[model samples]
Target: MKRFAFALWLSAISLNAYADSANCHQKANTPESIAATMDQALQLKQQLNSQPDPVVILVRQGQDMSSRHLTWSHAGYAMRQPNGDWRVYHNLNTCGTAESALYIQGLYEFLADDLVNQSIAVLRPRSDIATALQTLLHSAIKLNLFHSPRYNLIAWPFSGPYQNSNGWLLEVFARANDAQVWSRNDARRWLQLQGYQPSIVSAGTFERLGAKLFTPNVFTDDQPTELLRKGNVGLNSGDSVIRFIAHYSRAIPGCEHQNLGESVCVYLSPGAKRREKIKNRPSRREKIKNRPFYANRAACKSAYLRRQVVPCGPSSRIIPISVRRSRAASAAAQSFALRASRRC
Candidate 1:
């Protein structure tokens, strides 16, 4: 009996060790990777500090979906606080699980998440739109109105039962653009009226079936049956959302492209800037094609979680996405924790 008890203890320890190794959230934080992430974050901070608007839509390359022809994998709202600090508000899926929650994280925390590349994009809405978004970000009630705990990596842009991260951001943007957008349905309707087009992602039956069976975070039920039959899924993506915003607002001419009221810039790394650098600054469309996404934000006035002050310096190089209609592509792409603890 004693021998059997000792054996059971040993098995439990082995199981615990295996579980730690199997943690899906594990990241390879090499020194080079950590430095690159900090470089991106510091540059973003500078850009945000110079922004006149209180709120901007920030997109990042959280995962490498190049195989799927997608550049960005996540989008969030970065709002400047009264203290002059910037915080990112977005819904995040918990460790690739189907359940999700909203998170109000520091700029560093947002960028530090396991990233595919150090690319990010900034979409500065028109003055009025920015004002509306700023209010919405502060109001927990308004943000939660369209939020659903049920999450799917490929949630259909116009359906329910599941809402992907980008889908939530799109709906919230619609609400800010049009006051009549009170519910998720109303937001989708408003988006359609504004000519917002979701990118169609193509996946074969085997691929889709495999994802559904093994990955709890992916589902095709929210996708239209017609699309499913053709093996094409229409979903919200960073590129699609950016294009629609630029087109709907009317794209401006240069790097600092302006929609009817908003300003959009895609930040490129120094290395990329040299490789794809044009003789002269090109039109927004040309810049979009030539450069990657992302522009840095304001300085970090205070620190949260860990670390003292984040070193902020000059802004990173930025380019813009074109407003023209392009072939549809898809990329796979958080919530507030403070409020939940009180509830618990």
Candidate 2:
């Protein structure tokens, strides 16, 4: 009896150690979690298969700290595979690098965000649009041609030089909807004409300068003029993409406006009745007009230049000839620098 009790005590100790190790690696990509998520993905796949429409777009709030204010930050198209499982097609940046790649992954892999909180959004287009989007997806050449390796985090909605993940989806969406849009530039023009607004990140001049100097992934040329003029940069976040889709497509009944923390599943069949047509919301330009004058171009430019220029003072360094013209000029330069630093 004594020996048996000692054996049981040893077993308990072993089990406790195993539990501790598991807890330490809880956030790591473990096979058990992946398998569980796969099961969930299969369930979601079945639900999507029941929809009358064949294709739906998925949007999720990104896990990055920078994406906290945005409603959604990533998007991908989901479609049923030959085996009946659903797969997502989208572009992803190569681990914070300037390179990007087209990814065709399972729903589980698509939703594999470290900060995911058990919720996602689904956008189902009208039957005709769904068919068109699927048709475009079938063309490898068309998809590959636009798959740019240069990933710009701040890519403008209307730019062609570089593409962000959401920007790629936006371009693909444009091609799927319009046959005339054969190139990225054409797609961008279409989006601009439709008044599609990209999400704006409020970055001061010094922050922008620091990012440009230190990070290869931050590209500013693609930012929208209005946003850049206000010391902010435009980004193709998932929420903005969903809004753009909502502006153009009809949302299925019971599928529009999903509550937070609830996963959305939509089924669209050919015979399914179309929901109400989505109206175009106000443009970013219209919204910005209501903001304070400090967000305007002149103020932003002054603030930006001040941050870029070094301060003039004896404590910091010798004053430049331009700043040494007079005490008033030196004071003005110092004031400008201070304001710029404050903004930063």
- Best model number under TM-score: 1
> Any runs in candidate 2 off by more than 4 Å, and if so which?
1-27, 64-68, 224-226, 259-344
Give lDDT for model 2.
Answer: 0.61
Instruction: Give per-residue CA lDDT, model 1, range 1-344, as digits (tens).
Output: 43243233223211221111123655668998778767767778887786576988777765545555766667888998888888998877765367777878888777776554555677777778888899899899999997888877778887668887777888899999888889999988888877888878676676676666556667788888888899777777777867766543323335543232244676655544564556355887875454432223211211111212333333322222222222332111001122221222
Q: What lDDT does each candidate get? A: 0.64, 0.61
- Model 1, clash count? 23
What TM-score quantifies how close candidate 2 is to the native fold? 0.64
What residue runs in model 1 are displaced by over 4 Å at the alpha carbon?
1-23, 28-36, 248-263, 269-344
What's the distance in Å from true for residue 258, model 2? Answer: 3.6
At residue 212, candidate 2 shows an lDDT of 65
Q: How close is every model to the real structure, measured as TM-score? A: 0.68, 0.64
